[model samples]
Target: MANLNLTQNGNFSSLAPIIPAAGDDNGRSTLIFLGTGCSSAVPNAMCLIQPSDPPCAVCSQSLFVPPEKNPNYRCNTSLLIDYCQSDANRSYILIDVGKTFREQVLRWFTLYKIPRVDSIVLTHEHADAVLGLDDIRAVQPFSPSNDIDPTPIYLTEFAMESLAVKFPYLVQKKLKEGQEVRRVAQLEWKIIEGNHEKSFVASGLKFVPLPVIHGEDYICLGFLFGEKCRVAYISDVSRFPASIEYVISKDGVGQVDLLILDTLYKTGSHNVHLCLPQTLEALKRIRPKQALLIGMTHQFDHHKDNEFLAEWSKREGIQVQLAHDGLRVPIDL
Candidate 1:
């Protein structure tokens, strides 16, 4: 199983949340889960508002300790891929800076000593994904003496249209006459087609867009990205189209090194997200060497669910587990 192989080796363990010292990522790329919960996130506010007699085990446990110590405490789904180029340029490519992006930065960014965000890619225009773009300046701060360079933002035309309506200033900055530029986010919107065959470069790494259907008709994008290790990420997906399924399946591009997928619940159905059974089917078909499920709701108790995954991993011969906030896994690519 992946967990057994994980503990015995240091290659790719989903449970390893070891914080790297500044400038010491151990000479390899890293994949950090800034947040691993669904749009509502774990510890749902409605769960507490409409108090149950027994209360929610996951939400209740979430408050028992600080976020760092509580895997049950989760935020909007987000990921950070940090890597260094052959030119020694360290890049931080953030995927979907969500509503909780600032809070995540306060907690994980400081811990990881990430200097700045080199680029950003929006999965779609969902509020959970793009609401945090207003705070881009924090990731790459400008000084009083110099003008800040514009950070590149990659998105689909549909996503760009949404952002234009949501935050016009971000898509195109408006400077007043004779008004000095103060501290503000300088952003460069780069629109791209979310086609499976089309690949785009962010900073130094190449990313193949894995466009998947999100509810019934809505299209959301996931990505197959890696510089050294082949990592495929699909944070929000309901069902994979036949073509997409083939793209990630063992018979298609062959098994990926790591697969980060979405699982909205332990069982049952979600109009816009995959359930546990669906996730299992995906793991079996993709047959990734290791897998980590994200975009969870409050129904899952972190420790308990992870134990189940470990057992399931053993039975299935794939290392898969429930990922939590602040979880850091090492990746070669």
Candidate 2:
């Protein structure tokens, strides 16, 4: 159940829309919803709701959200942000290359015609979020003739330490003087640069790191992009701080246009992730024109969940959408 009391009459005129590279020349920014399902994406233990049951009722006519327990439900975690090819300096900045990185990269290359990834901004060091790092080798130049080269992988100093601990082979020094693996070679590391609090530009986009509590043992990051269109990707966040809220609402540089938040637990309470009710409460504070919930787990049937959310959002005057693999959202800037 969601509390939908979003204000629609506010002046968004001060905020310029994100224009995707496609369509009109007004410079609209585009957001492609890739990998909406949470870590236990379809077919996983949590998502495969109808292993033996019939098709989903709501998603029967049109397969918008994944049907209850459909085997086709994919991975829950993944996302890529492409700054349309407007500015010459604009390059593709990837957020959290999940276990499905190879698949996501191929899809992006085919759909967006991207030959090279400019940079990768990691959200955390979770396995599902960073496992696909090996796949970056595919995009690196294999031949000298190839023009585009390997992209830099960016992370916080703490995250890099965590990655080294988790994937020691990738970070291990040459044991016997043998050549390093091609995958390891593709990795060019850069620390997320800036004073701890202020916003900084890494890759091509302006990124502001909003540190949030993830669990007892670790801290997680949610990023705010651009001056007008603020996308706070807070997947594992348990609570929202006043500073975070102020940045997204009337107090900061601009109003949040889109919030891609985590809705992992709908009914239960996780010490780390934000529950559905909690997410809705945050929405009231930020009041973005549109909000998309990501990192969905199997407990939520896509269609039923979305239908419920849509109806609820309408009542609250907030526009909302559940993200999915290959779902392209264009923002007009």
Candidate 3:
């Protein structure tokens, strides 16, 4: 999301109608939901339920409408954090470059006129999270400064190792003798040890990585952005570590301006994702001023999920809602 006002465009306008005011003299940051679906995304290829099935109506409807028009028609989960440093320069930091990265980038360029991404941060090394790294070459030409400097990618050492094995060309620094140079994405890797106490700065923003359990063997990171507008985003997690709970607490109460969490389905725990009950429990612990749920599966119907969450939020007196693709939230930084 950019500071400029987002007007009604295609189908996204119908999903998120309230666009925040732009042009505040104070620094501003916007969190744009590039995609909000889980690994398989909405209308999963294997799930071709008929109209009689539970989520068939929503899934079928999403199939006909293009992603540009319907926020419910999701790709893979990813987010864009845009910081307006000044009226002249805007920097974009992307979280996760999933299989839909190219499509997401093209859509943003058409919708927000985003020239380039300043950096990237990976939550883990899951295929759905890092499969789109090769698409960065398409974005390279749009660099605002047009400098040859490689774009920085921040991740844990394990993630870096996984990337090295999968995309050796992009991570390699030298070309073999007699090997002709070809256009490819150039990236500089920054290893993050996932120490919650240690905060790191990138692209003029401070971030703390909260290490949490993804499953029995994997460790996923939930990021806490420390600035004027505090935001914590945990897109994929099965459980929160005790240290993360302490960090998000203020005195005795939870504190955060906006919390983006993982909610894979309405109920029942998955091996590597949080269920609705788990998400609700985390919400109670985090107690953010506003909360949005992501990593949804085809089981969730956009209209039904929102309607249910809206009523639940009202009853619980919390500003919790289901996030859709293309949703944008502005923060004063």
Q: Which candidate is the best by lDDT?
A: 1
> What is the C-alpha lDDT profile of model 3 across 36-68, one tens digit per residue?
999888867655644454546656766688767
Which candidate model has the greater lDDT, 1 or 2?
1
Per-residue lDDT for 1-333 in model 1, tens only?
225222321223333223223334566778889999988877899777887888877787755677788888999999998876776668999999899999999999998888889999989999999999988878776665337788898999999998889987666566668866566577888988899899999988899999999998899999998745678899999989989878877788666777899999998988999989999998998898778889999887877887888899889888788877887776567
Model 3 stretches astray by more than 4 angstroms: 1-27, 49-55, 86-88, 142-147, 250-254
Better of 1 and 3 by lDDT: 1
Sort all candidates by lDDT, best to worst: 1, 3, 2
Task: Give the range where candidate 2 is weakest over 10 consecutive residues by summed lDDT.
Answer: 6-15
Residue pairs in collision within model 3: 11-69
| Error of model 1, residue 201, in angstroms | 0.4
